[model samples]
Each structure stands twice: as structure tokens, then as C-alpha cells.
Target: MLTPTTASPRLKLATAPLMLLIGGFVSLQSLINGELASRLGTGLRASVAAAVSSFGSGLVLLTLFVLLHPGSRRQVATLGRRLREGTLPPWMVIGGLAGGLFVASQGITTPTLGVALFIVCVVAGQSVMALVVDHRGWGPSGQTAVSAPRLFGAVLAVAAAVLVGLQAGLDPAGAGLGLLLALLPLVAGAGTSVQQGLNGRVAAQVGPWATTWNNFVVGTTGLLVFWLVTFALPGQLTAPPRDWWLYTGGLFGIAFIALSTVMVRIHGVLVLGLWAVAGQVIAAVVIDLVVAPEQLGVLSFVAAGLTLVGVVGAMTLRARGVR
Candidate 1:
């Protein structure tokens, strides 16, 4: 088996494009899941169904792939042995719960918030927490100090979120509820940093695919129970839609999660967050323009530019600092 690369401060330029691609997958997943929710049920029931469908489908797919791969099977056994020996902390494997929270939040709020607004809110939360994750050495790449460039980059990312939020122009009558639902994605966004950190740790031991499978296992199980309690008990459930596109959220999610599992170790939490957020902002902006051109504004485009600047500045400045 190939040994995992050690987390290093040196920038790996080759990985930048892949990180951006993964970020685009995130926004795409939200759009797909939100559409699924709209077609499936109402209120929280729709959210639960969307979340369960995405995670459950991904879990099934990953389970089959892992079971079929001999190397992955050995890795799973090794992970179990490490757990028994107390070499790997049990808490490290629970990162999927964080991913599940983000997914559930997307399902609940994305239809109402729209992809661009929802993604910016997530970027707001993620950019802040990623700084904390890196500074505290919680991520797999180890401690990355809160340097001026890093801090400024985070501020820029958050500022971009604020710009998008201002442009969103929520309805006056529904502003209160809108604000409340927006907060859910904000909190869920923060959890993504934690999720990436933990998953990166696990991925370093096994492979990205195996780590992703484990995430699906834990996330799908948790979402299933949440759906049972909240939607199933209240009799809010509805039959899932037959549309093939509605189910593509899981495939997009798997791509992003697996890619992120690898990228987090290379870029560290904060830089990775910025890069992903940059890509997410661009994708979200394009999507909003296509889907709801009436809502597009100068500020939205400006926010996207700022996000790109922030990501580039963060990576370049950090690399310079390291050198």
C-alpha cells in the first residue's frame, strides 16, 4: 500500500484546480437537494427526505465499492484494529455527523434561500470556523497560525457573504423566518470545517474513498433517525419523486466529500475553505444568474470577485510566508 503524504506547509499548486472543482460540486449538490425537497414534501419533512435520500444513496454506493475493493477491506480492518488499540481516537470518525448537518441544513433552507444566498451563508460560517480549526491545530495539516494574510482572507470571505446577503432582498413579510432559517446554514457551515479536519485525519490512515464510505455510514444512519422522529412521527412523509435528476445530489456529494478528504490535508483547513468558498461563490453566482437572472445584482458579482481574490491572496501569502 502507498503511504500517505505527510501534511506540510509548502503549497501544492497542482491541487488548486481540484479544490475549486470540489467546491463547485458542493453548490451543485445543494441545488439538486433543494429541488428534491421541493418535489418530495413540505417544511422539515422535505428537508429530512432530501437529506436521507442523498446520504442513504451515497452510503449504499460506497458500501458496494468498499466491499468490492480488496485494499479497502484491509484498510477497514486496520482501522478497526487501530481503534481497538486506542491509536486512533474514536471521535475522529464522527465527522460525517457534521457533513449530515450541512446536508440537512441545505435541504431545509436552500429552496427558500436560493443556492447563492445559501452558499454565501455557509461560506460565512465555514471561513470563520476554518481559521479557528487551523489555528487550534485541529485539522490534519496541523497548526497554521492566524497570520495577517490569513486573517484578512477570512475577513474578505465573510465580507463576500455579507455582500450576497444584502443583495438577496428577503421578503418583508417573511424576513423573520428567513433570517431564522438562514442561521441554520450558518451553523451548519461551521461544522464543515470540523468535518473536513476529522475526515482528513481518517483519510490519512485509510484512503479518501474509505474515509468517504465511513462518512456516509455515519451520516446516513443519523439522518435516518432524525427523519423518523421529526417527519415520520408527525405524519409529514411523502413518496419520493421519480425524477432521475433529483437523486444526483448524492453523486455530487460523494465527489466533493472524497476530494475534500484529500485536499484538506494538502491545503490546511483555512486555505482549503477559502479555495472551496471561492469556487462555491463562482458556481453559485453562475447558477443564480441562470436560474433567477432577475435577482442578479452588481454586488453579487463583486462578492464573487472578492472571494477569488481572498483565496488567491491567502494561498500565495501563505506560501510566501512558509518560504
Candidate 2:
């Protein structure tokens, strides 16, 4: 029942607050994807639908904006031209696959692990990878050394995950499977970290709007193909309940992707990961409480607070330009 609408989306226009708000979207996205996964746990309907909604809605809005702003259209043209001339790395174009991986993994993991734990593990992965990625100068932000403070921050993030796992009281019977499923988001996080860097580079070439549009094109194509393949399996496609909130994932997806495209360029991957994780953990706690208050407890709150502390610690180091 959720089809792409014609209305343009209201984007976060300011560059400064984009990073902060994107955090909110990060948690929101996870919750939405988790619900979508639950609805289609028997099959792939939820993942596919979520992906399509994300890409289709974002593309439609982007197209409208580009048409109205000649400057934006020109930027898209420039990116195309540059790609044709081999000025940009061809790999940059595939950055959207990261989004595909994210939604797909959520479909598999979130229902089991819950959003708070899922996000904590994701932060662990992002913290480690972003440290390496930023340290190696793989992204446009240049090299940031993995100093003591940065290393400590990564340790804290890992600790946060451990705390959540402990609080969940992982059942020994299902521990293996639960841990395995939970780890899937770590893979998603790696994809996202790389995707952030690639999109950042592309943003330099075509501007943020076009960079996000390109991500939608590639990511949506991939998801749509997978969605079609799901029909071949034995499961039935389950439509989500008529709750309007279930359908808002795509909008949040667009917002965060666009925000990350810009944030990676400005703050680098590590900073973005830390800050975004802070947002995700905090938002996730509140969302979980609202969704199923009985499922959460004080330990969840502790995990969230720990994540913020780690993020703030890393941010302080970055602010000081610590070598």
C-alpha cells in the first residue's frame, strides 16, 4: 500500500546540524528496518519493500529538486562527465550497495537482537573500522592517527556491546545463532563505513545531492532485484499493518544517507561513526521503551550512556587535534 508519492521531501538544509540529526535518523532507520523485518520474517517482502521505498522515494524527491535548481542539475552533469572521462574512481559509483546491505542485514538481525543491542554491535564495528579507515587515509578526510584517545574510544564502544550482550542474558541454547545473527550488522557497518567514504569522494565530484541520487540508483536496483527473487522462494509476501509509522523508514533512510554523504566529507569516518553511534544508542533506547516498554530495563540505559561517553571521549580527542 506504500507507494512513492509526488511531493518533494523537506531535507535538512543546514550543513552544521546535519550530522547531529542524522544520528536520530540512524536509530529511527534501525527501528523501522527491525519492524519491517518482523513483518516479513517468513520471507523477503519487508526488506525489499523497505529498500524500494527508500530509493524510490529519495529518487523522486531528488529528481524534483534537481529540476528546479539548475545549479544542481549542472552538478549531476558534471559528475556524469567526469565519470565518462575517468576522472573519478569507477568504484565510487557502487557506494549504494552499502545501503542494500544495511536493510538486508536488519531484516535478518533486528527482530532477534533488538534495536539497542543491534546498534551497540554496529557501533563496535563502525568504531573499529572507522579507526582503521581514517587512520589509513582511505577516505577523503585524510589520515587520522589511531592515538591513545582514539583507541580508548574504540575499546569503550566494544565494551558497550559487551554490556548489552550481558544485559540481554544471552541464552546458552541459542547463543551461537543469536551471536551469529547479531554479527551480521557488523558486516553492514563495514559496508556503511566504506560507503560513507565512497559517497564522500563522489560528493566532491558531483555535490551531495547528486551523490545521494547516485546511491539510490545503484542501491535500489540491487534491492529490487533481490525482492523479485524472493518470490521464487516458498514464503508468502506479508504486507505490513496499516500503521503509518512503519512506512516512514524510507524518508529517514534518505535523510541519513544524505547527511552521511556530507558528514564523512567534513568530520571523517571515525568522528561520524562515534557521533552517529551516540545518536543511535540514545534514540534506540527511547524508541524501544515506547515500542515495548517491558522489554527494556536499566541495563539498556547503562549501555546507552556508555556509548555516549565513548563518543564524547573520541570527539574530545578529535577537537584537540591529538596526534
Candidate 3:
């Protein structure tokens, strides 16, 4: 639902800003997912529950879409055939995997780091890996040759992670573990770029909501399998969440997936990612101020500024279009 509702007149503005606004929802989703995890008692169970909720909501939306625009259904009717015949890249569904992991990570990390620092780490990870993903052709944006600007971007992101991680470790016994946990999003966040690319490709063929439906199926299934195998371990599966807000993570997820599909297509991943970075940072800062203002300080802003600098540096050359 990246598209604006008829009743909502404020968001009918130009495309770029709208996309950035949508990007900020990813931060909100992290906050909600974290809450859901805290209620559920473990990241693993929380992730599975959230994925199921996301998939359930997605299924309902897709059903409505199919009912309203029966024509689009015809377009995707060949989705199965095409997937089997190799007409579509099998990896387009990677968005689901990326999403599942992201929610899981958010659940695992957000409480400890708070929304602002947690999102900063996610952005830091995404900024660094996006370069490699672009260069290696793992991303939907196609091959982007490695360059000085991109390298500088990566360095800045790493430095920003360290800056943020230092604060994250301040009260903990194992600062090293804190540092590692802060940077874990670096690896997890890279999947998002890949997911955007693949999901964008799917949107090109089947349409935006349809693409999300596909992602829901894949991501939910992947997490379900993981949950079945791992939930038996200690400190894994616990009680179900009681709060209504916890369930809203799926709705937030649906919004962002659709936004990424559109924005990544319109603006290349560089601009889209960076623009969304601004949105997430702004939202994260606001959320922290309202809820846990004490967690963020000078170091948080410095890390965020460094991440922004990295994003700008990466855009110095080519952060857009096919190479």
C-alpha cells in the first residue's frame, strides 16, 4: 500500500519525498517488532509469529487486489510457469528472506540498543554491503563497478558502527559482544538490497502488491521452517504476545515492501536507500526522544551523521541506473 488513500490528501505530493516517508516506516516496523519480541519472550518465536502475521495480512490484501483487478491476476497467472521455466529469477523472492531476518534481528537487538541506535546499525550495515552487492552483481541494480567513493562510503559506515557500538557497550561486561551485536545488522541489512532488487523485478512483472504477496509466502515459509527446528531449544519459543500493537508489525511490513518495490524501481538503490536512511534516522530520533530519550546522546548523532556522510559519498559517482 505505497499508494496514497483517497481520504489522505497530504501524501499526494511528489514521488521522492513520498518514498522517503515510506522508508521511515521500516524504522517503525522495527520498533513494533521489538515490542512483539519482548512480549513473546524470544526473538525466534517473535520472528515466526510476525512472519505469520505479515503473511496473513498480505494474503488478505492480495485477495482483495485479485478481486478488484482481475486483470492483474491474469498477468501473474503465469508466475508459476515462469518461475519453473526460469523466465523469472528465482531470487526475486529473496525479499521475504531479507524481511524475515530483519524482523528477527530487530527483535533480537532493538530492546538492547533502542530504536535509533539499532536502525543506525542497520543502515550502517546496509550502506557497507550495498557497495559489495552492487559490485558483485548480487543486487537488482545490476553491476556497479567498485570505486573510491563507494569504498569511502564503506569506511564511513564501519566507523559509524564502531561509534555507535561504543555507546551500546558502555554498561555491558563484554564490550566485544556488544560491538559484534551492533554490527550484526551489517550482514543482515545487505539482504535488504538484494531483496529490493528481486522484489523490484517481480513488481515489474506481476505488480507491486502481487510482489509482496510472493514475498509473504516465501518469507513466512522460510521462518516457519526455521522456527519448527529451533523453537525447541531453551529460551526460544515462549508465550504469545498479548498486545494489539505487536500484531501491527505485519501491516508496517506490507507498507515498506511495497514502498521498496516502487522506490527501488524509480530511483536506483543508492538514492532510494540513502533517502530512506534519512527517513529512518529522523523517525528513529523522534521515537527515541518520545520513549527512551536517555539512550541517545552525542555519540548517536555522530554515528548517524557519519552514516549520512557515507551515503552522500557513495552517491558522488554512480548510485543509480544500470552500469
Task: Write candidate 3's Cα lDDT for 1-323 as tens digits.
Answer: 34322323343335678666875798888788777767766645655565566555656676677668877576567666678888887866567888677776777777778888888888777766767677777654467786666576668877888888898888668787777778766667877767766766676666676666677777777777876765675555566767777777777777776666666545645566667887887788888888888878889988878877876766665545323
Least accurate 10 contiguous residues by lDDT in model 1: 1-10
**Which clashing pairs does model 3 show?**
125-186
| Per-model CA lDDT versus the true structure | 0.79, 0.72, 0.71
Q: Which regions of candidate 3 fall more than 4 Å away from where they truly are?
A: 1-13, 89-92, 147-152, 172-176, 236-242, 264-266, 312-323
Pick the winner on lDDT between candidates 2 and 3.
2
- Give TM per candidate: 0.87, 0.83, 0.82
Pairs in clash, predicted candidate 1: none
Global CA lDDT computed for model 1:
0.79
Worst 10 residues of 3 by lDDT: 3-12
Where's the lowest-lDDT run of ten residues in candidate 2? 1-10
Q: For model 1, how does the per-residue alpha-carbon lDDT over 1-323 read when each residue is reduced to its tens digit? A: 11224644344667788878988999999888888887887868778889999999888888888899988888877878888998889899999998899999988887777787788778878878877887888877788776766677778878877776565545677766777776788789899878877877887887677778888888998898887777544435568788998898888987887777567667655566667878898898788778766655677677767777877887788768742
Candidate 3 — number of clashing residue pairs?
1
Task: Kindly indicate the candidate among 1 and 2 with the higher TM-score.
Answer: 1
Question: How well does candidate 3 match the true structure in TM-score terms?
Answer: 0.82
Candidate 2 matches the true fold with a TM-score of 0.83
Supply every candidate's count of residue pairs whose N, Cα or C atoms clash at under 3 angstroms.
Answer: 0, 0, 1
